[model samples]
Target: MADLSDATLDELREALAAELPAQAAFDGWKPAAVDAAADALGVDRDVARLAFPGGAVDMIDAWFAQVDREMEARLPAEQLSNLKIRDRITRLLETRLDILAPDREALRRALAILAMPQNAPRAVKLGWRSADLMWRMAGDTATDFNHYTKRVTLSLVYSSTIMAFLDDESDDFADTRAFLARRIDNVMQFEKVKAKWRGAGGERPSLTRFIGRLRYPAI
Candidate 1:
C-alpha cells in the first residue's frame, strides 16, 4: 500500500471506514480495531495514528459523518418537500436510525464510548451534527437565533432518543419511535410556550437570553 502521508484527511477517512466495522466486531472500537483494520487494508496500523490522533473517538466521529452522508443520499428529497415541518423532522430522524439498524452492536459500543466523562464533548458534537443535518435536509434556511435554538433543542431530543434506542428490541423499533414522538412533542410544546411568552410583552427576557447562547456549529 502506498504511504498515506500525502493523503487528505477525507481520503484517509474514506479508506479506513470500509474496514472499521468488521474490526470493531472483534475489538469494540479500541485502537486494536483500528490496527486490525489497517492490517486488512494492507497499510501500517500506525497510519491510523496519523489520520486520527484521538484514536477511537475520532473514528467514531468519522463513522457518524459517513452515516449522515448516506442518510442524505438515501432520503428522497422530493418526497420530503411536501411534508409538514414536524413530519419532515420525524422522517429524517427515523430514516437515520433505520439506516443504522444493521449496525446496532457497533452503535451500542460507540454510544458506550461516548458516555464516558472524557468523551462528553464528542457526544455533544455528534448530537449537534445529527440534529443540524436533519434541519438542513428539512429545508430550514434560518440564519439567526432560530437556527441555534432549533439545533440545540433537537440535539437534546436526539440524544435522549438514542439512549432509549440502544436497548430497544421491539419489532421495527416501535418502542423507540414512541419515545421519540413524545420527546418531539415536548419540544414542540416548549416552543409554543416560548412563542407565547415572547408575544406577551417580553415578559421572559432572562429566559430568552439564556437559551440564545446555546451553541451550534457553523453551517
Candidate 2:
C-alpha cells in the first residue's frame, strides 16, 4: 500500500485496470475500491508521473464511477450487456462491501434496521464518491472531504465501530459509530493528509524508487 504513493497516479490507475477486471469487463471506478484495488495491485514505488495541472483526473474518476454503476446488479438474466464497462463497476464495489459485512457486524445490523434502499445499499454509500479517494491516496488534497463525508453520509467502520444511521441503535451502534469515526480520524491525522488536492490534483509520479510508508500510521 505504501508503494502506491511513490508510483504516479496514472501508473497506479493502469495497474488497477489490469487487476480489477472491471466487474466482468466493464468500465470501472468505485471510490472505496479504487485505492484498495491499487493497494492490491502492488504498483511499483518508482513509477513516473507527468505531474501537470489540467490533467483529466476528474474525468478519469467519472469514467471509472460510471463503469462501476453500470455493473451494479448485473446478472445473466438481467442482460444489460450493452452497459458500458464503467457502468458495471458499481457491482464490483458493492461486492467488495459485501466482504466487509462480517468484519463490521454493525454494518449488517445497520443495513437490516435501516432497510437500506436497494438502489443504493448502505455499504456502497459509506465509501461511494467512489472516486474522491485518489487525492487522498496521492496525499494531494488539503480539505478533509473524506472525513466530512463519513459523519453525514454512510459512515465507514475505519475504527471497527458503529457509524451513521446506526448511531440511533441502542445496542452497540453508538460505540461502533464512535469507534469508526475515531479510526478514520486517527488514520487521517497519522497520515497528516487532506481529502482534496491542494496544489494540483494531478502531479508527476515520483521516479526515485520510493516506497511511501503510508503517511498515516494505523491506530
Candidate 3:
C-alpha cells in the first residue's frame, strides 16, 4: 500500500494520541482500552467505519457508545468553549421579536378561562376545572392555543411524554414509571372531564378546522 501522506500520517497520529491516552469519560461512553488497537496498527477508523476489536456487532455497540463523545469533539475547541452562545442568541432574539400584544391578549384570555373559580358556569361548561389547569400547565394554552383548536393535542402530548419516559429506561426504572403514572393520571382526569362535558352538552368543538387554518391562516 502507498505510504500515507505527512498530513494524513499526522491525522492518524492525533487519532492515535486520542486513542492511546485514557480520554475523559464524556456522556457515559468510555473507550474500553485507551491504547487503541487501530492507532497501534497505524490504521485509524473514522466514526462512519467504526471497526472495533470484535466483529460487526462490536462495531455497532462501540459506535453507539462513542456517538455522544464524537459529537462533542467534532466541533473545534473554540466553538465548544462558547457554551452560553445559544442561550445569549435566543434571549436577544426574544427581546427583538417580542410576543405581540394580540398573542399575549389571547393567552391572557385563555388563562382567565383557566383561572375562573372552580364553580363558575363557564368553567363547568369547559369541563372539570382540574383538566383545564392541567392543560395550562402543559403549556398548550400559551403559544399555540391548542386547547381551543386541538382537543386531542393534550392526549397526544400525554402519549408522547409517556413514550419518552418509557424510552428512558435509565438506571432508575422506578423514576420513569413514576413520571408515567403522574402523566397518565392527568390524562385520565382530562378524559373524564371531556366525557362529562359531552354528556352535559352534546357539542363537538371545531378543533380540526381551527388547527388547520391556524397553521396557515388566510389573511
In order of appearance, the predictions have TM-scores of 0.82, 0.21, 0.22
Number of the predicted model whose lDDT against the real structure is largest: 1
Candidate with the larger lDDT of 1 and 3:
1
Cα lDDT over the full model 3: 0.36
Model 2 C-alpha lDDT per residue in residues 1-219, reported as the tens digit of each score: 345565556655544543343321232222333444444555432231222122223323333443444434333324334544223322232333333333334233323433436524533443345433322222334455444433322223321232333334445344444444444444344233332333457443331211122222243
lDDT of 1 by residue, 50-145 (tens): 666787898888788888888888886897999988899899889878877777788888888899999998788888888888999999998976
Q: Each candidate: RMSD to true structure? A: 5.6, 19.0, 22.1
TM-score of 3: 0.22
Evaluated against the true structure, the overall lDDT of model 2 is 0.36
Better of 2 and 3 by TM-score: 3
How far is 16's C-alpha from truth in model 2 (Å)? Answer: 4.6
Give the TM-score (vs. native) of candidate 2: 0.21
Q: CA shift at 1, candidate 1, in angstroms?
A: 14
Task: Give per-residue CA lDDT, model 3, range 102-178, as digits (tens).
Answer: 12332223334334465255433333322343333233344443354223433333333333443454654454444
After superposition, the stretches of candidate 1 with alpha carbons farther than 4 Å from their true spots are: 1-7, 39-44, 205-219
Summed backbone clashes in each candidate are 0, 32, 0
